[model samples]
Target chain A: MTVKQLTLPELTEACVRLGVPGVGLWREPVRAYGTEAAAKLVHDAGLAVTTLCRGGFLTAIDPAARADALDDNRAAIDEAVTLGTDTLVLVSGGLPPGSRDLHGARERIADALAVLAPYAGERGVRLAIEPLHPMYASDRCVVSTLDQALDLAERFPVEQVGVVVDTYHLWWDDRAPAAIVRAGDRIHSFQLADWTTPLPAGVLNGRGLIGDGVIDLRAWRERVDAAGYQGPIEVELFNDTLWVRDGVELLTDVAERYVRHAL
Target chain B: MTVKQLTLPELTEACVRLGVPGVGLWREPVRAYGTEAAAKLVHDAGLAVTTLCRGGFLTAIDPAARADALDDNRAAIDEAVTLGTDTLVLVSGGLPPGSRDLHGARERIADALAVLAPYAGERGVRLAIEPLHPMYASDRCVVSTLDQALDLAERFPVEQVGVVVDTYHLWWDDRAPAAIVRAGDRIHSFQLADWTTPLPAGVLNGRGLIGDGVIDLRAWRERVDAAGYQGPIEVELFNDTLWVRDGVELLTDVAERYVRHAL
Candidate 1:
């Protein structure tokens, strides 16, 4: 829900009117609209802010960049608390520019978590480490597997930090089902986005909608359910093709697809 | 090298003149040049055929397709023996069309191996399962990690089956170093290719030349060496940008970069 279709306020209104009880949100839009105002809009409309989009990119090798990311993530956690969302999704940033140190980048994720976890716990927000697809391993997120995310999350209290189980990211891993089972109460957020091919230039916005691609979403849903995750399943399609569609129509179609394919 | 780079005879001449002891050949070019003639060209030049590019795509769900793949792989095994290469690299094909069955696809690789391993072992051609980068999981290859390849390889007798450790395909995995150590004698082939971002449209030709990107190639070499491997380090760059350059010049640059970065 970052750009393309509707504003955050508009999306909130649409979600509430459409009886979508829970809505996940990105930070910048909420910031632009004023976080308190955005929070009030969803809160008054009787919608729960399921999760704040992200709070971690703590893998930057640069001191200034690293400091900036931590500051922004702290603000994101505060915003999450303000919006009444218990979950704050963190996309651990990828290999820092011109750096081949994946291990170092991953260690930085742990270092940042050590600092942010207590702050997040204080705010009653769970840091949900979202493992992006392996394609994003070099640029977007180094956390490329559910097992890796789970390993990182287990280092902290489950209430303070947890792992995100997104079908688009984790479906390719054979160990994902078992990892999901092991996640148990550590599974703070579950997202559904199908894997589509001929990934566009940059490969970032090529995700398919719930039933549009080959992922067995119902199987993933069942796996998560078996792990004791009784939460709103979010349909998070970041496709350039789907971005052009009318928001209401897209939401309606996705809601129906979610029922048929993901449930 | 594939056809985009060199004619077999010309590549053999370049290898001989450049003092490069071995060269990897692809199936299509070998078939085109006549496997016997391609064998003669490299053999006469005293160049060891490090590996035949590929021999498996056995994940096709169609019975006919699967049978054809096995038959073709058998032919590839014969070709590998003719070319005097012990390794026949297997890029395990991706999910069958319109299917999300990665586990099933992977199982097909094992099934195919059960048939091909004995066939290969008899001919002294070890089946090397090469895991392509996970970006290829949807369409190109399902085996996307060293451990996944190792899992399949470990199922077969060590002499008949083994794993390929490619730095480009494997560097991002936090477990890759340990996987390489665990690979031990099972590592049949080791390749060096750097990962460059802003991955082009198809993403196939987006590989960076060894030193030009951020993969710690020397580290991977050390890991493989620690695992008791002292083999030809094939510098397999698939960059469209590098492809258009003069073959001799590209080879020279790659050789120099390989020494500087990968050794």
Candidate 2:
């Protein structure tokens, strides 16, 4: 959500003018702009829809909540299909309210994927399990390592379920490089969000601009390329600092940073 | 540092009155109180000296800074010996200034240990590598996982080098339980701190009181016990809220929480 300030039409127009080839769309903004119109705008502008933002928060303990999550995921899969993107990135939800059963929560994610993966496969959408940084493990996602995500994804068909390798989340992990290699062709979506220090309160929106942090972005790019990932390398940042800037300027800056740092 | 509010003397007196068996001492306070004097105070009060707070920041790039870290660690080893504690917990420092080499930083820690482990062992003290949480990977400690700590610790004799199992730092990792089992007798010190949400600004001092947050402290204690760790289970909390409370009351609460939540 690096340039979240941009409306879908404005984003698509800017992308076309800037020679950007694809745009990954988050559900909220796409839903707000009407997903069909949003998809058409990007398609008419000759830009690919890289990946849908999300599809999973499947750790709800209540039966009703679980059913609602499943329905929401099914809708997400349909939206991905409508957007003509085969990948739906899943920030699998964290532990239920007061529960400390990490294993149980993770198992629940697997159960949700068991039902949703086949449905997504039928619709030509692969659920990309995004293992968020461990700082977010308590309230965001139980899957904190690429190894763990691969463990969960390997249980399902590689065509149905895969992993999203985000540098911000996985850079601290020494095992992640090897895990990325092991992920190989199952790497559905590759994302870049730099990690910066003295994280702002809540630690959710402190993602750095591409070149502002300490990550070896180009190294990550080369690693994923070597791992047989031929997917779009999306810059998916959640930064409060960048969001306040002009959307077109931020998008241009992001494009420049991607080429200079990530490419 | 659950009862950091208590002075060294007050801490020993309170521990004695509360039937607490031992206490872990931080170098700063012990230095302020005079290491020998602090040791005598705890011993005279019939309390065991559990473990020393820290000794490692060995990732400095500059020659002068690296030398200072080694000297300081040597002092810490000496202090641990004087305090009659066999364990000196090491929080290996993070990446050096402006550096993105996490692997290199970790290797520097190994290099430092290669120099200091034997020094501490010669003085009848074992260096306990405490892996700080991954959130601190950028600026605090590069050792972000128990397995990583074990990887470093296993390079030396078990009597000379070992790992600390802290609930707050390791509870997010699914692989930690297995790593603890793998650690076996190399588990030097077992610490208890809970995982709470909406982490504070810097994310350093937000460690929850023993029973206040999401971690299953007793389960960790039991796991370490199963791994053959028969050592002090120190409650180390860095909460700003707890620090402002009455020291005696906080100490009493921590003791009660230890029994109720971590025993």
- Pairs that collide in candidate 2 are none
Residue A172 error for model 2, in Å?
Answer: 0.8
Give every collision pair in model 1.
Answer: none
**TM-score of chain B, candidate 1?**
0.97
Candidate 1 lDDT tens digits, B95-134: 8878888888899899999999999999999999999888
**Number of the predicted model whose lDDT against the real structure is largest:** 2
Worst 10 residues of 2 chain A by lDDT: A1-10
Residue A66, model 2, lDDT:
99
Q: Write the per-residue lDDT of candidate 2 for residues A1-263, one digit (tens) a residue.
A: 67888888889899998899999999999998898998888898999999998988999999999999999999999999999999999999998988999899999999999999999999999999999999999898999999999999999999999999999999999999999999998899999988788899899899989989989999999999999988899998888888899999999999999999988
* lDDT for each residue of candidate 2 in B1-263, tens digit (9 for 90 to 100): 67788898888889998999999999999999999999899999889989998899999999999999999999999999999999999999988888999989999999999999999989999999999999999899999999999999999999999999999999999889999999999999998899999899889889998777889988998999898888888888898988999999999988988889878
Error of 1 at B215 (Å): 1.0
Among these predictions, the greatest DockQ belongs to 2
Q: Which 10-residue span in candidate 1 chain B carries the lowest summed lDDT?
A: B1-10
Native-to-model Cα distance after best TM-score fit, residue B170 in candidate 1, in Å: 0.9
